[model samples]
Target: MIPSTTASAAALELASAYQSPSLQSHSHRVFIWAAAYAREHDIAYDAELLFVAAMLHDIGLVPEFDNHTLSFEEAAGHIARVFATGAGWPAARRDRLAEVIVRHMWPEVDATTDPEGHLISRAAALDIAGKNPDDFTPAFRAEVLAKHPRLNLVEEFLTCFKSQATRKPTSSAARAINSNLDSRMLTNPLDAN
Candidate 1:
């Protein structure tokens, strides 16, 4: 189940206000995907923390929160930290929230150390690039898409990454472009199916 918490609700609200509907839906699906993966792997995770991180993990990509210098994930981490602090989370928990968001962009995260981070990283990859589509059944995938349709996400996200790459050539977004992220996204099986 999606975590029910004041902070979690607020995170969704924040993303709704600043992000496109496509992006907002993607954020919610991130949590759902992560939660499912956690269950499949028997990984213990903080639901509320993971939910909140998923809701705001792409906040940096929203034009309102987009940074002039910081990479998008770094900007997202900072935003999550500030949001968590306002929610009355302890400093360490706030740090963890930020760390989880930033870690989504990383290639790997040890679940034993940061279950939330590992789930988010894997789930975000699944959603964005269609990695591990077999991890969830076809019916489950259909239901997810029915509830949160792609709604032009492929177009919007690719454009966002291109813009991000031009402004921040050293950023992961740029690296993704160099690594043919566009082709992977365009040919993503999820979008096709």
Candidate 2:
């Protein structure tokens, strides 16, 4: 079964309230992709934790929470940590989840050091940029996307990242926006044929 818990549900609720419909859909796709990848590769992962991480990964992009002082990843990590703490997650697990959220913005993550983090990072990369689009079977990708359609994700993400980069030019989001916004926005992963 897809991993879920009270904590994960709460995270999803928070995200749904604050995030756009497109972003919420994207977040769900991230979880689906991560879980599917873990299953296909025979990699063990905590579904509940991955669910929470994927759902709240973009919480910092929410306008009410975005202060433009910290990087979006850092802000999102802080939000997730607070939620995890209130949900009675132990420090170690909470920290791991936070790391997963923060590291999702990395250009690449080493799976050896933090498998969950790496999975989420790669999943977000796949959803946002279509990186390694062929890593999974075409049917698997189709199933995930069918459940959580893109909803014009490329334009939505570009708009979000551009706003963040414009507001916080020194942040990692800005760096990423400057470097990858063009390619990512232009290329549609679902269009692979």
Candidate 3:
């Protein structure tokens, strides 16, 4: 079961406040996917931290909190750290949470160092790009998407990433867009009409 702590609740509230409906749904799907992956793989992790990290991984994309100069991942990491610190999380915990948020954007993450980071990274790719649909049963995917429908997520995600790329040309999102936006955008299994 996904753990619910005060910090995790606060993270959800912040995500709701900043994320668009599509993005909010996406965040929830990320959590569901990550948790499901953990359960299926028998990977022990802190569910509360994973929940918070998955929910707020895209917080930097929110216009109100975004610093145009920094990559969205970096900005989101700083914001998550600030939120965790305000919630009285220990420095180590806050740093770990920040690492989870920051690393979600990476193409790959080493699970040994940060299992939460690795799971969230894999889960986000699965959610966004349909990278490993076979890992989760079709029933699991149906259940998750039924609870939080995509709401035209592919288009919404591309638009958001395009905006970020435009503002921060050197950002990871920009590099990704330049490299293969169309292929990634086209790969979402949920978007099939």
Best by lDDT: 1
**TM-score of model 2 relative to the true fold?**
0.93
Q: Could you tell me which residue pairs clash in candidate 3?
A: none
Off by over 4 Å in 1: none
**lDDT per residue as tens, model 1, 119-191:** 9999999899888889999889888889988889989999999999999999999998888988888877778
TM-score of each: 0.98, 0.93, 0.95
The total of clashing pairs for model 3 equals: 0
lDDT of 2: 0.84
In model 1, where is the ten-residue run with the lowest total lDDT? Answer: 184-193
Q: For candidate 3, write residues 1-193 as lDDT tens digits.
A: 4466788888889898889999899899888888888888888889889999988898888788788799888899999999999999999999999999999989899877788999999988888878888888777788888889889778877887888889889998898789887587687776652
Per-candidate alpha-carbon RMSD to the true structure: 0.8, 1.6, 1.4
Can you write out model 2's per-residue Cα lDDT over 1-193, one digit (the tens) per residue? 4455788778888888999988999999888888878878878888898899999998888888786688888999998998999999999988988899999988788777777788899888888877888888888888877778887777877887888889899987789777876687578567553
Alpha-carbon local distance difference test for all models? 0.91, 0.84, 0.86
Q: What CA RMSD would candidate 2 show?
A: 1.6
Tell me the lDDT of model 1 at 5: 88
